[model samples]
Every structure is written in structure tokens, then in C-alpha cells.
Target chain A: MSNEVEETNSLKLVTPGHASSETEGRSVDAGPGDADCSPDGRVPYMMSQIQETLQTLDTAVDTILGKVEELHSKYEREGLAENPVLDACREITFACCFHDLCSQRLNIVLKSLEEFGDELTDGSNGTREEASILASVGESETRSATQDVQGGGSLLNGPAMTGEGLSQEDVDELLKSFEEFN
Target chain B: MAVDKNMPVLIVDDYSSMLRIIRNLLFELGFKNITEATDGREALKKLNRDAYGLIISDWNMEPMSGYDLLVAVRKDEQMKKTPFIMVTAESKVENVVAAREAGVDNYIIKPFNGATLKQKMKRVIGDF
Candidate 1:
């Protein structure tokens, strides 16, 4: 039941004053990308696969990290040396976070190149504006900027964040820079 | 040995996150020109299209893994000279020996940091 409410809220974030009824049948809401989505709002087959794979990988990382956290909590009172393992975990988290956001954005560029092969046949003339236009992909946060992900928020669950799309952490960070980006 | 920081480098891995992490480490070490491929087949495609100073690839992937890629690259006269570095989680001595026999220039174990990557890069393409 809570999933329904969370999903509904995710639909609400598509655009200010946009009608939720207009977005009813879409299985996923990709934030800004909704504006450009097909009427049925399905993601491209390849992009959906990529998003699914990335989400699985992110979940795997989260699972491992969670285990480490649990270990840390379990061992803290044992008086064993803890800094070495904790420090390594910190570094691993940093690397994982950086990799997650940076690669998702890079995949966007690669997908654009694949989809619009004719426009970029020459490869040299693709402009920043063209990239931005394509970046406004009609999917929920297929990815966020490195700036948005630095906080270790659980943004991978989907554009519907915590349970659905944007988590509170993700939404707050995104809102801080929303006006600047738009 | 000395190396050119600006030389084009090709990195291959099915996991985009692994690619991103390696690319960032290379970037930090002053190497800027980088291309990425998800499997050995795609890496070969890029190898055919352009010259790379080095190739760093993971060992496991669908349709093509880094070992097959290394053998193919070694067989190709044009790409045989390009330094190849294999990256993977496998630490078994036999795996390292297998990569070496296949003509890999170096090997990197997974969960590596910038220093380890830089050290591997030094062994293959020389110090940056």
C-alpha cells in the first residue's frame, strides 16, 4: 500500500502543475525525462536494460556495504583494532559512489550516440546543447550528477527514490541545485 | 621508462562502475585520453578503429572475456604492440600465469586503488 503512495508521489514530481492523471499508466517516472516520453512512457529497450543492470549492481554494493556496517557495529565494543577496516570501507564507498554516478552519465552519452548514429556519424560535431537536450531523457533519474550523489543517498531504487523515486536525501540534494540546472 | 600522458587508452569491462573507477584513477595520474568497451569484441572493434597506447580490461565478460581479447589483440599485427593490462578479482597463480602466457603486459587484482593502478601502468606503459 505504501508503495502505491510512494509511486504516486514520484509521478507528482514530473513537472509543476502537470496532471497526475496524464501519467497514470507509465510503469516508471523518470523525473524530467517524462516531458519527452512517448505517450505510453516506456523507456527504450536498451536503456531499460542498462538501468536494470545498474540498479542490481547498486543493490549489490549496498548489500555488501550494509554488511560491513553491521560488522562495524557488532565489533565496536570488542576493543579490536577497527580503523583499518573502517578506513578501507570508507574508501570503497567513495569509489563506489563516484563510479555509480559517473558511469550512468557516461552511458547516457553512449546511448545517445547509438540512437542518433546518423546525426553524429562525423562524431566531431555533436555539441554540448545536443548532449543536454538528449540528457533531458524521459526516464526517472537514470542517473544524477556526481554532485548529487556525493552524499551516499539511496538514489538507485528508481526515480521513485526511497521506496519509489527520490529518497529524502536525493530530493533535498536535487532541490538545492534544481534552479541552477534548469 | 617514460610515457606520454596524452596517449589514447582503451579500458574494457562489462561493469560501467569498474570502468568509471579505473578511468578516474587514470585521469588523476595525468592520463586523459580514454575510451571504454564492455567486452573483448567491442574492444577489438575500437582497436581496429583507432590506435591506443594501452588496453586495460577485465577478465570475465559475456561473448568475450579479457583473456580471449588479449589473445586476439596479440594476434593482430597492428594492436600486438599496444600494452595490455588484465584486471580481475582472481588471484590464483594459475590465472596470472595464464594471462602472462597469453601475452598480457601486466595484471591488476580487483579492489585496487590509484597507487596500485599507477604501479601497474608504470610496469606496462612506463611512468607517467
Candidate 2:
């Protein structure tokens, strides 16, 4: 009976409890009362973080754009009409347009985050419904953008190529294919 | 009529960066007379103010898209015959078909370099 009591006590020591040394090192599964249960509070925090990151990106783009414009003006004033230099300037200017593209895409994300934050802070049953609706809207937008990139469904709905843009050879081949079809 | 490189050309896009890029490309192609508008509505207002020899426009814009602009241009008696090229990131066949049906002279996909732009312009307005 004493051995049985000792075994029971040992088992109790291993069981999860505030005072159990054994339980200290083991991670307990989170329950409804845990700090992680209400993640709604973190939504605004995450949104703010994203907003800050986007602002940084915007500032970087603006600085690059400003520098390019200044270089373009300098080139013009210097009467540097060298073809290669002019061509490089043009290419750099074209590349700078990526900031606009990024801004457009980021706007979509920011809008979605704002909607989600609003839903989270509402603290009503409608929060779930709103979240669901927002999620679906986001999903649909993503799917549509994907479809546009993939050239899925109608051939006329999206970009000609996915990431990295189309090569000159690819463009030529596409033109040929179109001509062949026509 | 053969394209006159100095003839006034109108470029339209909602993104100013895109407008600047297109203008630069046109400039590189030896097109000296170029005008820019931020969107289709602005393009229309400019269209009424001046006669453009050619119109190159981005398809996606708020309020009035390039398609709407094209339709409006086609409907107008004065601008009906102007060479119009629809530039868009979208390469969907449906959009191509619709633009074709709507009487677009040519289509150019985005991220196109000067060489590609030159070729497309040559096709639309004849070799510059």
C-alpha cells in the first residue's frame, strides 16, 4: 500500500499543474482561456506594421523616382544625346514604373487589411460574417489576379506572360502563333 | 497616311509613372509631339481640346477604362479614324477579341521595351 501511494504521488508529480516541476518544461496545449484565444486584438497591430512597411517601400520608390528625374534633367541640360546613354535612361525610367505597379497591388492589400481590422474591432456576431465576406472577397480578388496572370479562361483577360515579363523571343513566338491562328 | 513622328500623340494611363514611361518610350522612338492624361476621362477632355494623330492608352483605369475611351473615341466623328493602340498588362484573348471588335488598331502587352513598342507602332501607323 505504501508503494502504491508512492507511485500515485510520482504520477501526480508528472501531471500538469502550476506547482509541478515536470510540467514546467512541457508546453501545455492552449485552451480557450489562454492569451492566444483572442487574436482579434492583434489585427490592428499587424495592420499598423504592414502600413509602416508599405510607407517605407513608398518612400524608397519616391527617392529612386526623384533621382531618375534629376538625372534625366541633367542629361537634357548637358545635351548628352548619346544613343546608349539615352537608351539606358529610358530603360531606367521604364523600370521606375514598377513603383506604380507595386502601389496599385499594395493598395488592394491595405484595403483588405483595413476591412479586416474593422471587422475584428466591431466585437459583434457580425464580425464573423464580415470576416467571412472579406475573406471571400480577398480570395476572389486573388483568384482573379491569378487567373489574369495564368492566362486562364479567356485568353484576352490577363498579361501575356507571368513573372519576369516576356522575352523578345517569346513575344515573337506569340506573335507568330497568333498570326498562324488568324 | 504614313505616320508623322512629329504629329501630336496622346498617351493615357491612371498611373503617372506609366504615363512617364510611355512618353519616354515614344520620345525614344523619335516622337516629339506627345501629350499625356491620367485617365480615360482626362484623355477625353484632352481629345476635345486637340486633334491627336495617334492614341496609346492603358486599358485599366478607374472611372473610365481604356475600352470605354476607345468606344467613346470610335463614336465621335472627328476621332473615329485616329490610330488607337490598347496597351494593357492583361493578355487575355477575350480582351484582345473585344478590343479588336471595338476597332483597336493594335495591342501591346506591358513590360514591353522600346523595340517592341517601335514594332507595334510601325504596325499601327506605318513605319516612322
Candidate 3:
């Protein structure tokens, strides 16, 4: 819709279908909007209007940049960088809003994995394991999206989780060791 | 009596990561047979399709919450005697009592350890 509006404005500056043809070096008799064309073939009024539209586009770009900056700052202030739930919720919201921007959603998914570090920082000591586990799982999509490593290197791959080599006793011992460390 | 390792365990939670973690933790505890559902409806479907010896569920989930799942399980002739445990982030004493009244064999609050999970499972399913 906005593209149609912009194209219409550009068309008003020249003959509608001839606009591209004119740019490609094909000359046509000046239309009503091109009356300011000089005898030598330069259209001063049309050139100035094009320049003005370019300036407007430049300003619009600047405004979008400013809005992105403002959003980033607000996100920082909200502590979304440190909260898994907030990060995941924001990622989903972004995906919904910018449905066409697959790269944006993918990046958000990867960045949200930092919640794993947040979990480690908060640590599991004396916290309700079920809640912590739930929170961790909620953020797991992010971690999975960013997983470049293979061979069971994920957080799931504890020492006892030796890429399917260890026995159940080894897993228990690993859990015990992790518990002791925590 | 010992838990039947061959019997499938049904883990119900709204979060996928928690399900994976729980499944892995159960695997570590020597229970290799496990299945998961994201909510009560899926859980009920899975329960109908398979015979699960034990169920671990989260209280807050859509379309047949853990509480609803427990009630449904108890009402089902085949699953009536199966052990049910509620794992939830809601830590209120009243909530625990309500779960107990709903026929939950055990309950665990969130942020629990693998040891706590194992102990709870042992209490419900008998020693491994």
C-alpha cells in the first residue's frame, strides 16, 4: 500500500509508464507535469521534485535508525538482556511483528540463548529445581538455535553424558558431582 | 517392589526444554523408556495410546492441566492406579494440599534437583 503511494507520487513527476523508459534514455514528449522542461531538454522542476523526494526518503531512513536506537535502549533498561522469560517473549513478539524478516527472528533466537549464562549466574542453589528447569527449558529454543557444536556438547551433555558412552551409574555420579559443585 | 524399567513414563509439561531435561534426568535415573506431551490434551491422547506406569506433570498448562490430567487419569480404569506426581512452579502450601487431594502421589516445587526428582520418583514408583 505504501509502495503504491510512493510509486504514484513518483509517477506524478513524469508520465506514468514512461518513467522507467525515460530513465533508460528513451525520450518522450514532455507531459503536463514536465512543462518546466528547458528548450535544451532539461526538466528543472521535475529534477527538483525528485531531489525533494530523495531528501524525504533520507529523512525517513534517519527516523527509522533513531527508533531502532530508542528500542535498543529501552530493551537494555528493561533488563531483558538478563531475563530469559523476557527475552523469549520479546523474541516471539518480534517474530510476530516482523514475520517477513526470518534473519531477524533467527538472530533473536540465537541471542536469547544467553539466558543459559544468566541461569548459571543465578545458579541453582536453594532455588526450586522445577522452576529453574522450566525456565531453562523455556529458553532452550534459543540455545538450540545457536547450537553450532555437535557430539552432545550441549548443557544436556554433562560429564556423565559422554555422547552415549556412559552408563547410568556414570550419569548419577555426574549429577552428584554437579550437585556438589553447585 | 521395584519400578518396572520397561514401563513407559509420561512426562507432561508446557515447556519443551523442561520435558527434555526431565526425560534426560529420568534416563540418568535408569528409566530409559519415556514419552512427553506439552499439555493435558496431548497427555490424555498419549495416555490413551500407551500404558504409562508413572506420570510427572506441571500444574499450569493448557487444554487439560496437570490437575485435570490427574482427575482424568484416575477416572480412567486402566490408568486409575498409575502413580502421578505434580511438578510445579506454584509453591503454595494450599496448592500442594489441593494436588494431594486430587490424587497426586507426590509433589515437587520448581527449581528442584535431579536427586529430589529421583527421590520423588522412588517414593511413587517404589525403589528402582
DockQ of each: 0.04, 0.28, 0.02
Q: Give lDDT tens digits, candidate 3, residues A111-133.
A: 34444434444454445565478
For TM-score, candidate 1 versus 3, the one ahead is: 1
Better of 2 and 3 by DockQ: 2
Winner by TM-score between candidate 2 and candidate 1: 2
Q: Give residue A92's error in model 2 in angstroms.
A: 1.5
TM-score of chain B of each: 0.96, 0.95, 0.95
Q: What tens-digit string does per-residue lDDT give for candidate 2 at B50-113? A: 9999999988775677877888899999999999998777555556656676778777777666
Arrange candidates, best lDDT first.
2, 1, 3
Output the number of the DockQ-best candidate.
2
**Candidate 1: residue A166 lDDT (0-100):** 29
Candidate 2 chain B worst ten-residue window by lDDT: B90-99
* Candidate 3 or 2, higher TM-score: 2
Candidate 3 lDDT, tens digit per residue, B38-107?
9888999999998889999987665556777887888899989989987765444345445555677877
